[model samples]
Target: MKLIIAVVQDKDSNRLSKHLVKKGYRATKLASTGGFLKEGNTTFLIGVKDDEINDVLDIIQENCRSREQTVSPVSVMGGNVDSYVPYPIEVEVGGATVFVLQVEQFHQL
Candidate 1:
């Protein structure tokens, strides 16, 4: 058995969960936060047989996509002033970080 841990953006969580359930794969979703962006995220825990690993991965790939975004730097402008930039910069966002682990045992009651 394998444990698939997928941490996806909050916006994509609903769609991903729906797709997983539609494909007859059980998943547990938890509220989480991203380390880099410090944004809201959703963590999914799925325990599946070895043969089904690819299927789970396919669903995640289809649902999670990375793109560019804009953000502003955390610095003062106009010298020794407590003012920030009026506009934000662009950066990359919207992706999934996944991890697959071997499970020694799995039981459901």
Candidate 2:
């Protein structure tokens, strides 16, 4: 068995989940946040047999797509001000960070 851990963008979670269900795959979704962008994310846990690993991977590849985005850096309103706000900067965003691991055992009640 294999455990597929996929961290996808929040925007794509719903669609991806639906797609997986339609394809007869079960997945558990959890809300997550990205450390780098501090943005909302969705984590999916899928348990699949060895033979089904490729199918799960194909589904992820089709759903989780990466794109470039522009983002701004944080800036201070005034030099004397203690608080600071981020300014809009261009940066790349979107895409999924995925990890697959071998599972020694899996049981469901």
Candidate 3:
């Protein structure tokens, strides 16, 4: 068995969830916060057979796309007042961080 942990941006979470459902994949969703962008995120705990790992990964990759976003570093991530830049910069966001782990045992009740 494999445990897939996918942390995706809020914008892509809904879409990803839908896809998983459509494909008959069950997942446990958790609300999470991102450290870099200080934005909402959703973490999915998906348990699947080893053979399904690639399919789950592909679904996550296809849904969570990385795109450039303009954000003020100081306002969002925070910075020293002395070295604050009062300008918006383009940064890439909207991607998933996934980890697949092997499960030694599985039991559901």
Candidate 4:
């Protein structure tokens, strides 16, 4: 068995979950917060057979897409504190960070 931990942006969470369910994959979603962007995120816990790892990954890849976003620099993230920059900078966002782990045993009641 394999445990798939996928942390995705909040924007894609709903869509991803729906897609997974439509494909007959069970997933549990948890609300989470991201440290870098200090934004809301969703963590998905998916348990599946070893052979289904690739299928899950493909679904995640197709649903979670990275895109450019403009945001004002914040002082906490090592931005210029002394001066104020009115213009917002472009940064890449909205991607999923996934980890696959081998499960020694899995049982459902």
Candidate 5:
């Protein structure tokens, strides 16, 4: 057995959820936030057999697409507030950070 952990943008979560269900894969969705951009993200915990790993990966790859986005920096409330100027920078977002791991045990209660 294997566990597939996929962290994807909120924009693509719905679409990816649909695809995963249509392919008969079960997943647990959790609301999350990104560290860099502080944007909403969805983390999916999927458990599947070893042979199904590639199919789940392909589904994630097709659904979550990385694209450019302009984001303004968040200002911190500190001494440098007077000199701090927030600037919008182009960043790459909307992609899945996937991690696959081997499962030593599996149980359903």
Candidate 6:
């Protein structure tokens, strides 16, 4: 068995989950936040047989898409407030980070 852990953007979570279900794959979603961008994200926990790993990966790849977004820098409180300026910078987002691990045992109760 294999455990597929996928962290995807919040915007793509619903679509991706729907697609996975349509393909007969079961997934559990957990609400999460990104450390870098401090944005909402969804973590998908999918358990499948070894032979089905590729199918799950393909589905994730097709649903999760990366795109660029412009965001302003966050200013810290009480530091350099007198001469602080916020600038919007373009950064890449909306990509899925996936990890596949071998499961020693899996049982549904």
Question: Where does candidate 6 have its weakest 10-residue lDDT segment?
Answer: 75-84
Task: Put down candidate 3 lDDT per residue, 1-109, tens digits, no spaces.
Answer: 9999988998888899999999999999999996633579988999999999999999998899788889876665554677566678887878888889989999998
Query: On TM-score, who's better, 2 or 4?
Result: 4
Clashing pairs in 3: none
lDDT of 1 by residue, 62-89 (tens): 8877876666655325574556677776
Residue 87 lDDT, candidate 3, scale 0-100: 79
Model 5 pairs whose backbones collide:
none
Q: Each candidate: what lDDT?
A: 0.85, 0.80, 0.86, 0.86, 0.86, 0.85
For residue 43, give model 6's deviation from the true position in Å. Answer: 0.4
Model 6 deviation from the true structure expressed as Cα RMSD, one decimal place:
4.8
lDDT of 5 by residue, 34-93 (tens): 762348998999999999999999999899868878766553324666755477667776
State the local distance difference test value for candidate 4. Answer: 0.86
lDDT of 2 by residue, 22-62 (tens): 99999999888976324899889999999998888888878
Question: For all the candidates, what are their Cα RMSDs to the real structure?
Answer: 4.7, 5.2, 4.4, 4.5, 5.2, 4.8
What's model 3's overall lDDT? Answer: 0.86
Superposed on all Cα atoms, model 1 deviates from the true structure by an RMSD in Å of 4.7
Query: Which parts of model 4 are misplaced by more than 4 Å?
Result: 36-38, 69-91
Model 2 local distance difference test score: 0.80
Better of 3 and 4 by TM-score: 4
Worst 10 residues of 3 by lDDT: 75-84
TM-score on alpha carbons, each prediction: 0.75, 0.73, 0.74, 0.75, 0.74, 0.74
